[model samples]
Target: MAMGNSVKAPLGHIQFCEENRSACRGRDNSPVVVKLTEARWNELIDLNTRINRQIRPVTDEKLFGKLEYWTYPRGGAGDCEEYVLEKQRALLAAGWPKSALLITVAKDVKNAGHAVLTVRTDQGDMILDNQIEAVLPWYSTPYRYIKRQSTREPAKWTGISDTRVTTVGSVGN
Candidate 1:
């Protein structure tokens, strides 16, 4: 994805960072793109599939009775944000560089706001979505790319300048 100038992080993500400060602190020297090894590729695919099956897709309003409450799917259910966070956390615990796993916001096929995990590797930028089973290249997905966590600073975000998109602007959840 072509990331534009720095942009404001989604409100949910801002609040999430406030609640989980440690996760937001990324090392300045962490690799922005990962070296995609066969083993690491398998791990990404496996983790995406496992999380898709493990968490029931429930909106934050339904689960937390509040909007934009980013959290883990500890209750076996959560929204898209929860799935992304869980994947990011798991990958980090498995020794994946923090800069390589990013929290991304986008407009799905339906043009609705959605959260996903964007894994940046030497091969390409692949997306792990709760709504999709396959781990796909960011361009392969039908999202109108919005913004994502900066590789240099997880607490900051940058806009996505999607060449294929011009019709969509702004975000809603």
Candidate 2:
């Protein structure tokens, strides 16, 4: 589906993006146009599962005693955005193209804001969510898609056009 134009990121995400500009910057600031192999797919799934299981979920208010949105590579506990940042870093370190890994924000079934890592592959755009153990296509998730980091520029973000409700399912990338 064609996505909407670029949009402003959430305040918290904006803060995180600013603080970690160097980390987010990529050698090539373009969308991924390659297909992923089965081995690469398995590696991504393993990394997602490992980080999700390793990091205990904690709200920013509880952890910081304030409503702040920041992303970091936390070892023990962190919120959704932190999880996404960690996964993105790991994938990049593992030699995955930066354009393929995007940090995305969406609303959950209850309309609560959430974050997930969107992996763009030749097959489709797949999501690695902290709430679910499995990697699934972005369209199959329960969340209402919103904006995601722009492929042309990691610092910029674009709005998503697909708002169709999808049943939760596992789909390989």
Candidate 3:
């Protein structure tokens, strides 16, 4: 897929860190920091469950040059990234703060990279994954998160792990 084919994610998830320091620091982004009351959180969870159904978990063509739409083996397929992207849009359409949503890249215990959505609440962070929509705790995921960018800030993110996973020659040009 080309640039035009690239789907636009929610505004809160696309922050540029250097340009939006306030948001990157996890401050002052309306969409990223939802002020949802307890009732709203429960409502959001319901909405997420409905949206999660549209996504199917698959592992195909992950290293194909630059992945555009998370594809499956049967020609057209969407992985967790595409699934989370669509889920975020659905919640936004249903009147949820985009800031309360996050897209995270993490490595599972098997070291396979995976993507999932994070929902911030007064209690703690709730995770929405293609594998399930029960909204689990962040630590409940058996994956080690590498980085995450909020929809409120497109370019800025945090929580990158060490580079030892790759060889030094793969680090720079």
User: In terms of TM-score, which candidate is strongest?
Assistant: 1
Per model, how many backbone clashes are there?
Answer: 0, 0, 19
lDDT of 3 by residue, 1-173 (tens): 00112234323244223333542354435554556587877876776776666545544345344433332223334576666666666666777666667677777666876778777766667777777657777766666666665444544455645334332234565
Off by over 4 Å in 3: 1-32, 35-38, 58-77, 150-152, 160-173
Using all chains and alpha carbons, the TM-scores for the candidates as numbered come to: 0.92, 0.89, 0.61
Candidate 1's displacement at residue 87, Å, is 0.2
- Give the lDDT ranking, best first: 1, 2, 3
Best by lDDT: 1
Specify the poorest-scoring 10-residue window by lDDT in model 1: 25-34
lDDT of the candidates, in the order given: 0.89, 0.83, 0.58
Which of the two candidates, 2 or 3, achieves a greater TM-score against the reference? 2
Per-residue C-alpha lDDT of model 2 across residues 1-173, encoded as one tens digit per residue: 34799899778877876788886565564466448789988997899999998889998888878677677845588899889988998998988887888889889887898999999988889899899889998878888888888887787788988758566657898
- What is the Cα-based lDDT of residue 142 in candidate 1? 83
Alpha-carbon RMSD, each predicted model: 4.6, 5.3, 10.8
TM-score of 3: 0.61
Task: Indicate the TM-score of model 1.
Answer: 0.92
Looking at candidate 3, the ten consecutive residues that score lowest on lDDT are 1-10
